[model samples]
Target: MQDLPFDIASLHAAYESGTKPGDVVAECYRRIAASGDPGIFITLIDAEKAHAEAARLGPFDRVAKPLWGVPFAIKDNIDAVDEQTTAGCPAFAYEAAADAFTVAKLRAAGAILIGKTNLDQFATGLVGVRSPYPIPKNALDPEIVPGGSSSGSAVAVARGLVSFALGTDTAGSGRVPAALNNIVGLKPTVGALSASGLVPACRTVDTISVFALTVEDAYRAFQSAAGHDPADAFSKAVTTPDLGTAPPHPTIGVPDTASLEFFGDAVQAASYAAALDTLRSEGGEIVEFDFTPFYRVAEMLYGGVWVAERHAVVGPLMDTAPEAVHPVIRRIVGAATKFSATDTFNSLYRMEALRRTCEAAMAGIDLLCVPTIPTFFTVADLEADPIGPNTKLGTYTNFVNLLGLCGIAVPTGTRSDGRPASVTLLARAGQDSLTAALASRLHRKARVTLGATGWALPEIPEPAPTLGPDEIVVAAVGAHMSGLPLNGELIRLGGRFIATASSAPGYRLYRLTGGPPFRPGLMRDATGGAIDLELWALPLASFGAFMAGIPAPLGIGTVTLADGGTVNGFICESAGLEGATDITEFGGWRAYLAAATDRQGAVP
Candidate 1:
């Protein structure tokens, strides 16, 4: 076995350079045994079977199978053929006849299954210690409780035992562990990945999540497993947006000072402040919003009727094997029996009202940045007051799924006390790509190593300007460009920045006659100079609506790029150029704005 970086990009590079999959598998087992953590896996796949599967993958072919030859682990609650499907309760364990919908998709994509990882028994607890199995040690520090119920899956990825792993998230089961272990955890939108075979905790809120050493690797796994599943009634055909580039001057919402909670952990609080500063340095505008409504929504997840949904799945088990269930989990889920049908309806109504309030608070905010876990607790702390500490740990996470949001937890940096400092970027459903794009940039900027592996972060390649079949590329020469006053309109319409380029040499730029928020128009001229422009992709379905909003004299027309490519862009009629200022000498709207600002400041 050779020492290898297990990130998707690094491992694929080694595969391209002649490292065989069999060798990688051998290394995986070697690391697992050497890890000295006995609770990471509940059942290991037969080494012979895994090697045979790898051998069958043939030569490296990332195009045909994006996850070809990649090794991964699955939370035990999710079924895999021939493996015992245990929701961490041995009595509830049963042999699976077929793989879960998501599992089968990964298998088809050539990801090798390594084992079934441990989790909170029946996936009921945020603390990993609820399992009948030995607790998985925190990959970063042994004293701290390994965050759960996706504890084992996250620890495996953080410790470099697997390239990635599948974890289930209901109330931050997926993301909390990643934050604790110093890795990436992507909780995609609900129904984005099928939940057909997953042992239900809270069926309505549960989502299959990805844990990886890097944001890029997690997103790759997500893309492979994401799609509609006819077998799952909750599954929808959600399209994963293309993560083109980091949005310029993103408006990030943070908890207002009055609502921020750190649970007395000053180090973590300071770390979060630094993380916000990092975002500010990256051209992000920090907007502090009153988080009271969001906090109320979080309380509702475990405080109200949602807990009854958990009982719907495991009520039979609780009745039959009362003693078999962990005491803490039994207490939590058993409380659901006290709620009346009327209580459920009332709670649902309240939830809808809270959702509206949250939406209003989130309006105009591109992403919400929050401490992944408000504070960290140790095993000793859990033993002292299990429920209280666990509830506090979820202070920032419980409201996400309830609000139908997507989020990714990424490591910011190590705290002053040598603990992991992390923040989760969240957005409304279907904005997974936007959150990921920003998370990836922040993670790289932090310069954190890949989990506990000590491998330097891999260079993120610039995504190419490739449009999905349902998308149309448009070039923005002025206000619609990123960081400009009118850029919000394009973003609201699902437009993503692709790249910055120059128009063909035959084009000239003119500053249209307008006050306040000025607009620029491009036109073709034989002696015109190339003008800088920004390329963006908009959904084909929204193209007509976007074009209809264009005012007279400026309309969508084909414009040639310096790269010899043509795209729909803003073009002005000859009559409209009558009083328009020719700003072609400034090359771009941004340059012209900068010069104007400088000249104003130079006044007496």
Candidate 2:
């Protein structure tokens, strides 16, 4: 088997161990050229320019600069300074002055830009073939359509041409391509990656997504690229949730059998079932839910208001020179002109109601797993019924962004009939880290090799441990510390152990005057105060619920940790500690718990 060290970690290791970035760039070009796949990149960067950029990057230093020496590609629709922004439309090409906010972030993090890859014309269609330029052949099967607008980006990473690539996902463009090519596609929460330099493909719904051979690579790319961009109106300011590891026995949801649309592909259905079984064996609880409302939300995209947004994006371009656009793309974007402003308003009204319905159904599910696409179709099939089969390909995907959710697609297993089968895990917006964690586990569980190159599966990289929405680190100095009786408060809220440490060397712990839970009041002091505590991960939603039940003097607030990470923790107003007993004698929370237990003659 061919050696497959295509993930960012391995590439980083090689770089650190003295492999030159220029050499890797050369190797990448060699492999991409040898692959004989002309459809992958619409504009390949000059080798001399790429190698010069690589040479300029001094050395690997993940701390000072993550993504160091990691080579990546961007979808043509995303602006990369000096690269042609063809967007798969040769007639509409132009040179960009600066990198898109998304690309600029990656470049700042030490990623090298390889070039621009092809996409559906103006990112208008789900089918890869809806491009004036050549369609990227499916990495897994040449006869099949490499699913759309982000098609070439997906193929580029899947073929190991680059460690990762940037793709835009509006209505599954990012995810469908990943599914079709058997790679990881991370469609982060909208506004997570700034869209400043991206050509609008329905500006409201557009997001720059990442494609990589491993979940960890894709996730790391997301972390480095995701941040608030003041210049981009759609950018939102939100902390990156901790992309931590999954806990044992995770709860995953799947659409009920009646709601699953396999489009008569028994092989694909069976593959998904097997994938679920694999997840089960790995200690996941699969919950079945009615997905009708979710599908209804998806219908609102093209059938309701979103098409108008699409039309809004490219209508002017179409009117000026209709011949420049691909026929399928022209038809889809042209149809948007038929809807009136009132129709759009009605669609918006109906969509808000549908979003509520979908959220209600998803309220308790940890993660929802669905077939990335209902079925696979060939180029001939797409040629015969361009829109119908293409729409079917988005059966499990189209509704995600429309309903304000985030997702990551991972290849699961090949269908019995030999086509690739992939699954996407969806969660509410801002739950991106959770989905990535689950996708990482699923990728390892699948144990599939790299797409088409027949390269052996690289060692699954460890995702960086960080806090997630499902967890909030809290510093507790009192009875609520781990293993203490009152610790049940955290446990009941699905909290877990993180670490034991002291507050920033300037806090005092005081035993509250009274109470059954016997909470400790922790406060910052001017001098001679050092309080010990342990940090525990509490689910965000449950943390709010837990906080609501707090009594007077005790509240949730930021605590500066020894390691410099901020965590919500126990805090008390100065007044609440007036008559309290100082308990700084105990070195740490565990010792305090031990002392308390010894005093009671109980094993803690």
Best by TM-score: 1
Query: Per-candidate TM vs. native?
Result: 0.94, 0.81
User: Taking the tens digit of each residue's C-alpha lDDT, what string does model 2 give over 24-78?
Assistant: 8888888788878788888888999889888777757888678888889999998
User: Which residue pairs show collisions in model 2?
Assistant: 242-467
* Clash counts for all predictions: 0, 1
Q: Give lDDT tens digits, candidate 1, residues 95-176.
A: 9999999999998898999998999988877778888899999998889989999999999999999999999999999899
The deviation in Å at residue 308 for candidate 2 is: 1.6
Q: What's the lDDT for all of these models?
A: 0.89, 0.80
Residue 308 lDDT (model 1):
92
- C-alpha positional error of residue 529 in candidate 1 after TM-score superposition, expressed in Å: 4.4
Residue 591 Cα positional deviation in candidate 1, in Å, after optimal superposition: 3.8
